[model samples]
Target chain A: MRRAIGLILLLVLAAFLVSGMLLVHPFGAPYPTDMDDYIIENAQNQTGSNSVVASVVFDYRGLDTLGEATILFTAVTGVLLLLRAQKRKEGGS
Target chain B: MLSKIVRTVANQLVLFILIFGLYVIAHGHLTPGGGFQGGAVVVSGVVMLLVAFSSQDLKKSVRERVLSIMESTGALIFAILGFAGLGTVFFYNFLVGSPIFGRIPPTGPNSGDFWTGGFIPLMNFAVGLKVIAGLSAVVLAIALFARGEEMEE
Candidate 1:
């Protein structure tokens, strides 16, 4: 009885997972565009260059990238701190 | 270890790829590929170098902290450019209009040259340096960590 219940639960979870994957949109579908479209369209006025991604990264989404860099810095600092003590332990070993 | 003939060919091919990567990085603003893509390609060459020379030989060449600092400094510079832009046009592009430490391109609005007095080119070099260093650091860390795992095994 217990084995049957477990198998039923597993089957239900597998069904849900397969259905979720199948519901994803395919390529070439007309998706709704976001604020990035308008930004790219007007990037010429702002940066005087044809590179839209550069305009977006350096000018428009600058603050977001700044925050991301800060996060990377913190993570690296943490790794260094963790490894520093490990080196000391290894030296004693 | 690769055979002698294969190793020689790989080494020559890697050098050529590295040169092409450098060209892509240097002419990023005026060309198609930018720093990150070029940096990754360069780092792949570095990876090939590691594969050719082995980890024991690679230790004397690459250091960890220096690469970390390079990556962090690149981020710092990009942030500084952001702040400078904010000061002028409140998040405007190329608003600072000053000599940005290094060579500022002598192109302007009327000059029809995309290489202008903005920090784009400088930022590309910084990002290229940062990404190359960062990726090599990762490869180094993984190599070391995996060595430990192999020892355990």
Candidate 2:
């Protein structure tokens, strides 16, 4: 059938897409710039704390932490609401 | 008897653990430990008490009302602290102020003091209480509700 031929063509296209990624990674080189060093130097100067990751999380990326906390709060609220018991009718009939 | 002695020891141990957990939460900013860990530890102590004594017996010591209030108030304090930091810097690290909000010495050391810091220790204690109460409520509710008899819903 024509559908079988179309499926084969799609499979070939998928194979090409996956194989293309293998060709790109080997030749890629990483370049280290002076800006990276300056960033480290300035961070040390401003925040007395030596913990770069903590500084980034609590200070520079604080908005991200706030958003994450809001997401957690929302999820907890949703779970609590779902778990709450529903009121039933009082009459025994 | 042996059971009586075991119960006495367990009670004392649970109390000590709870106090240590609170200390960890209180000194979180200065020390390596913080709220979540301390809260979990405190809840473990609560679990110990529940296990050593019956659930009904444990209920006599700590009420649901107190736990719920602790949770809600902790959340409120956390929100207030968030707003307090908005004046200076973003989440400006409010763990550097005095215990009584705006008191003498304009707070304490830069980053080393345990009692110092704006709202860090308070927030830690609040979060500790909140987590312990919330988790204990969840576990207690589940345990009670799963008893085969139909609950009021």
Candidate 3:
């Protein structure tokens, strides 16, 4: 019975994934590229960066990058906290 | 642990890898890679060192405190740069018209100027430093713990 239920769940997940994939637009044919076109055309002039992707990431969407940096900082803090050696007290139990 | 031959090769190649990573980070505004990519490359070099050498030897050279300081400094620098633009807007391109990193490029594709991109390059450098220090510190911490575990066994 357990195996049967697991198989049913797997089948349901596969059906959902397949349906989602089918609904995706065809490769290299994206819809509503107005934003893309605008960024490509004016990124260099506005951001003064030759790399459009860099301008978009660092200039246009700066807050998102800041958040990513914060996440990395928090992760490092967690790692340090978990791995640091513990010191024993002489008087305490 | 790796063999002596692997260790020697890693030691010799580490410098080149680090230089390449720095180049990528510095030229991020004009090239394909940015802060994250360049920082990952640097971390890969550090990982190579960690794999080639013993934890004891690594501890002698690279300290956890130094890496932690670097990580914090990078984050602080990024936040400060953002705040500098607070008069206009959050993350504003305040340096665009200024002398530093303010050279506006032509509309079409061409070779990029180094002193352009306003605050973008600065932000990239900050992020790159943060990623390099953070990831290397994490790996170093894990490696140290693993060494302790082995010693316990």
Candidate 4:
């Protein structure tokens, strides 16, 4: 019974993923490109950055980058916590 | 640990890997690669070193404390840079028209400038440092723990 339920869940997830992929726009032709056009045209002038992608990532959407950095910080902290060295008892043996 | 031949090759290759990673990080604003890619590259170099040497040798050279410190410093720098733009808005490009990193380029394709992309290059460097330190520390910890487990057996 558990295996049956697991299979059903997996099938449901696959269906959702397939439907989503089917609904996505075709390659190289994204819908609602106004923002893209604007950024492409004015990124260099506004941000003074030659790389449009960099300007958008670091300047326009910088808060997202901050959040990404925070997530990385949290992950590193978790690793340190988990792998920290534990002291051995001197006389336990 | 691997043989002496593998260790020698890794030692020689590590320098080139580090230099390439630095190049990618520094030229992120003007080139294709960015901080994440460059940092991963650097971490790969560290991994190569780790694989080539014993855990004891790795511990002597690469300390967990140093990597932790580097991670913290990178995060702090990133946060400070973000908060520095609070005068106008969050993450404002204040250095765009100023002296530092304030060189505007032509619209179309041309040779890019080094002194452009206000706050971008700095952020890239910070993120790069964070990723390299964090990943290397994690791998080092895991390797050390595995070695400890072997000793217990």
The global C-alpha lDDT for each of the candidates, from Candidate 1 onward, is: 0.63, 0.58, 0.88, 0.87
Candidate 3 regions with alpha-carbon error over 4 angstroms? A87-93, B1-4, B149-153
Lowest summed-lDDT stretch of 10 residues in model 3 chain A? Answer: A84-93
The residue-by-residue lDDT of candidate 3 on B34-98, one tens digit each, is 88999999999999998899777887788777888899999999999999999999888899979
Better of 3 and 4 by lDDT: 3
Q: What DockQ does each listed candidate score? A: 0.15, 0.11, 0.58, 0.55
Residue-wise C-alpha lDDT for candidate 2, range B1-153, written one tens digit per residue = 137777788889988898888887776645566666687788888777666676666656666567666666766666666677888865675544334422212222343433343444555666676677766665554544454222122
lDDT of 2 by residue, A1-93 (tens): 899999999999999998997766465563564755554554333433233443343345556644544454455445445455555476556
Docking class of 1: incorrect
Please tell me the interface RMSD, in Å, for model 3. 4.0
Q: Is candidate 2 or candidate 3 better by DockQ?
A: 3
lDDT of 3 at A75: 92
lDDT of 4 by residue, A1-93 (tens): 999999999999999999999999998889999998999999989988888888888888888888888898898788778776656665564
Clashing pairs in 1: none
* Interface RMSD values for all candidates: 6.4, 6.1, 4.0, 4.1
- Tens digits of per-residue lDDT, candidate 1, A1-93, equal 999999999999999999997777765663666686777566555554445565565557756655655665566555544433243354552
Which run of 10 residues does model 1 chain A get worst, by summed lDDT?
A81-90
Question: Which one is best on TM-score?
Answer: 3
Chain A fold similarity by TM-score, each prediction: 0.59, 0.55, 0.84, 0.78
